[model samples]
Target: MATLSSFLLATSLVLAGCAGGGGGNASGTAGGGGTAGKPHVLKVANYFATDHPQNVALREKFKPMVEEKSGGSLQVQIYDNSKLGAEKEFYDGVRNGTIEMGIPGLIMQADVPKMAVGEWPFLFKDFAHAKKVLEGPIGKEMTDEMESKHGVHALAWSANGFRMFSSNRPIASVNDFQGMRIRMPNIPNYIKLGQLLGANITPMPISEVFTALEQKVVDGQDNPIATLKASGWYEVQTDVLESKHMFSPNLYIINGKLWSQLTPEQQRILEEAAKAAADYEWELLEKSYEDDKKFLQEKGIRFTTPDESFRQAMETAAGPLYDEIYQTYPWAKEMVEKIKAEAK
Candidate 1:
């Protein structure tokens, strides 16, 4: 039997080959320009399943648009299901130009901690407000900082939906979260949030979450409803609380070196395609969330809707972290204020 580590390694190598090997040429001409025969192959990596809305948009919409606009000058190869690597690995691959593009998750906060401000517990009014703040000046500033400091260019940001808590045990109120062992991504802000919520934070990669849950290593985990369903986490989790505590947006990033290598026309095509794909995915988010919720209910996962008093208690508990975040990341205060001002 193949171990998980070995399976991941083999998958990475196979996908790497597919990304690097330009199997065919539209024409024989060879040059930087997208002339007759020389086509620029852009490899895009994502951790989502092939059926996920984001992947569907990339493969069906983004790829076709970029290819058509480039007039056979560009070919896009997408590696879904973490074929390239995990979220952090994907970011590293893009930064080093091993991968041309990736939609790395909030792990991007490691590069630009100011992004943590956008994810404050119960920050935005809803998804539309979150979208507005991100697509506005605040998002641009974050993108600029990333490109300037991290050597990765942000193409566009798309919705990852609001994160909710799922547990093996019922969590009907804020008091129920006290001392609960909760699995969280290994990111500073997330750790802090879990701490503020009175959870015994257990940081682990997303891939290990299921096993952790089944073995009862952690009492609960949090993710968007769609993610819980898509990842089959509902099978392990019995109760879900609609905390809607954080709104996460996935950023599509390209290597700075790779971006610089592209012709101005090529860059425009890629950027436009990314934007279009982002919009398409955002359109699907609400429906996907609703469908996933229905699916979970049908599968017998108990759901909890927090009362106003419970929500207030959660907010009160997490509010102090705002000052802590500002102290840790100097720019975070300003970004948080900007996003709050923009949020409806």
Candidate 2:
């Protein structure tokens, strides 16, 4: 087995091939853009704010390591806040080989519907369980499938934790959600979950979420508390219902054709850098939850932990949606079952 260092070296070589011409931009060379001898410049596209802790953590932890290890041979250029277009657009860009890499949601069904298998609502019990499945065999299989079917290769999996609910009105039970309009990702499973819980679901891009709440386009939205605080949604919505629903797992993907063309040494470097960033980002996410909640609390955001009965009720109501997902992808169902069995 190749070590993590070997993976980054191999990835660097792959990136070099994508650049076509041998010369490298000074800005994209090494950390500051090195000389022409550098393998390739890595353009990393993400929709998060440049200052967001996760993004900061990723850069602080991974970028320098990749550059130094590659001896200023790989350049990493990060574009934040949808500079490379939104999540779906980034996915398409990677597929078309327009973008070298991006971190996109599993819900991008248009580009890779099979990847959406992991986003089925309420599939995970908690964070640890989520990590087990995502970093384990099931995720590996899906990652392999993505490379084969979509010309995308997964470098690592990052978490957004289990998503929760936030609204202007206090949401203590499923009853409180009745007639509420909740903004959700443009995914069928999300729509079904809202419907199951008696909320009118409004599907939209993540960028529009805060605005929708402020404009009353939706009465509520579901996401991790960390996101609600980080994105400044608390300014518009005062009440938070901590209903850990779906675990939003993001994929750090590179164009497969581009990745395959790299020399093994360069590839090794990119993989090492990605793994380090993944671990760093996840740790930041875990720590951010408490700090985020505390900050929201200080800002006068009301936090409501729903009763056990309500959680069970919501899960039961949404259970049928799982059946629909299973019907859509029987192989994923099998993989999920195997994961559940192993968790025992």
- Best of the candidates, lDDT: 1
TM accuracy, model 2: 0.85
Question: What does candidate 1's lDDT look like per residue over 161-273, in tens digits?
Answer: 88999999899887888999999888877888889888999998777888999999999998888788878888898999999998878988889987887777788888899
Q: How many residue pairs collide in each prediction?
A: 1, 30
lDDT per residue for candidate 2 within 197-284, as digits (tens), equals 8999999878888789999999989888877877888899989888887778887889999888776667777788888888888878
Q: Provide the overall lDDT of each model, using Cα atoms, as 2-decimal numbers.
A: 0.83, 0.79
Off by over 4 Å in 1: 1-38
The alpha-carbon deviation from the true structure for residue 246 of candidate 1, after best TM-score superposition, in angstroms, is 0.5
Candidate 2 has an lDDT of: 0.79
